[model samples]
Target: MRPLRILLLLLLAFASMPLAASPAADTLAADSEARWVPFQLTTGNQIRFRALMDGRWVDAMLDTGLSDTAVSASFARAAGMKPLVQAHADAIGGAIPLAWTGLGRVEIGGLVRTGGRIAIITADPRATGPDAVDLFVGGDLLAGHALDIDYAARRFRLLPSGRMPFRGVTMPLRLAGSNNLYLTELAIGVRVQRGVIVDTGDGAMLTLTRSTWRNSGAQAGPVTSAVAYGAGGRVETDLVLLPDLRLGTLPPQTAELRIEGDTGFTARKGAAGRIGGGLLRRHRVLLDPRAGRMILAVNDAAWQPSRSTSGLMTAQDGRRLKVLHVMRGSPAAATGWTAGAEICAVDGAAIPSAYATSAVAGWSVGTPGRVVQLDLCDGNRRSLTLARFY
Candidate 1:
């Protein structure tokens, strides 16, 4: 949370109100209770949960990085919400305007908060359809409760304040500003960095600030480039494999580390990086702001880096499959394939057009050591054998 960019409209009397009338007070009055709610992992690797917003059922994401709860602008318009105040949020790439409105109530798995001010923002284009996420529940709304996410079971639970949901290793969660968000320490090969933000909204395993990554002493390895979309806009990113990452007393694990270029959101005061859902999915995570700790219980003992065998990441573009990234040292990269190259077909099968309802680009990650032929839009054909790049 930062200073306001502009004031579009205001209701002076209501402007002084808090988000939820002190969630801690409500938590203290209630006994220990837990309610399990199912969630879905979107294609982008985000946590999507079913929630009730103003009595209407909608999809929501549990995003600890956000300071306040928000609804998609389309959802706000459809629900006939009136904006009370206007502000701006500094996001991944830059600042984004926000319109504050009040939702009568927002509930997820029986954990309800009322009379809260919600920000109206735009949703990603890929997040559409009847089951798309229209709401994002942030730290401000869940400050009083504990969040228990069981990634293996694809479920989440909300516990009353002071309730330690699991008996597991814990790490200190430090408050970041007045946003109710937190940062925790992360050890990368014995070099401890204490400014890692616990961000469930992000899909990447770990993202480091350019300066932080440069000084991390990471071992040399194959590097890949990719694009990410967020609040400000699209941003180019570089990815690498990091070895020996330890969280609290957990065993060392290998994970993919993303390096944010200049203009990325990883730059925060005294912040080293952000840990997102990609790595958290391998463990049962408990976030207790009131307790000032985050607990982790390993569900998948064999945690490994998520890498492409073919070293290629493609996206649907018009009537062709656009090569968005090619991992250095990968089979695809060895062919000198760069970004913006279009493939008209894969293994002789025509690539799906942008308007096609089905995805037929499965050949992008075919069996390892198996040869897949790509027909380029330039009327040239190339073949490569799938193999682990990093």
Candidate 2:
């Protein structure tokens, strides 16, 4: 009788405790403590943060697509980092010689990565906006941790490594590659199992190299030729609607993706294609690199419907603005602007590199009756009748 009373009293005591007082709950509560620094989520969720380099604040961009930290040569010199070794980097334009250097210290919102390695690209990367940055914070710096990226709220925070919060879908992240970029199994196609980089900087829905697309056995349907522009200048691609595209067990997403027929750059094992911010913007993403897991709180439904198109993507060349990717059935495509087609002039007047971005939208969208003249590097001149919708 006494033992029964004691058991009853213990049950009562357990029931009277707070809801989240269990051992597992306590561990979760304890692990949730992490330092989260606020960052300005600019266009396309480009992570822009100020970092202390050589006692000076420098603008930095966190690009998950790269494995090693690649800093601008000018930035390296400015930071007083000397050349450590001779190196070469490959871009859309091809391989170029560069110098490898290291910073004394890279302080990110008070978090420090000592002796950060950097590759000095002689000139600015292709995708530099008006506010060009000095650094590319790659996975080398972000490895072995959980990063929670909230696109809608523009929140970017870091969680404890190897510890996952019990919220959102968790997937596997594989780092078996020689590089530091995290890889995961996505349901794109069979032949293309590994080469997908989970990148937030990429604005496209899905981008696959020619080999990846061929391996996937995805039949080429009625398609439009496009030029995909990135840090590497331009890639000629085919833009088509992948009706049977799926990401793991998630509902098959019909995406108008770009297929790079001629990817000038050599991608590593997990580098053929990418799952970009175009798809990731639909949810609150949590990336646990340490555990190789991903948690997604979906804010958008799947297989909804059609959206608008820009049909035009451009990149900056030395002193010229060139057509990097022209969506098939886009305003630029109709004008026969292939990859490497330089925009020597806009409306018959030469435009500088600094004003190149604004020049495209201002002259094309909603004008209805403007002609953007082009002077191609291939020595063929063409004129594009401009209209809205890319």
Q: List the residue pairs that clash in candidate 1.
A: none
Off by over 4 Å in 2: 1-34, 189-192, 217-221, 262-272, 300-390
Pick out the ten consecutive residues of candidate 1 with the lowest summed lDDT. Answer: 4-13
Clashing pairs in 2: 173-292, 227-324, 227-325, 227-326, 310-390
**Candidate 2 lDDT, 97-174, residue by residue in tens:** 567655456655425666535566653344544467787776766665577777666656555676555467666776
Q: Model 2, 79: alpha-carbon shift in Å?
A: 2.4
340-360 per-residue lDDT for model 1 (tens digits): 888888788787553234444
Number of clashing pairs per prediction, in order: 0, 5
Tally clashing residue pairs in candidate 2: 5
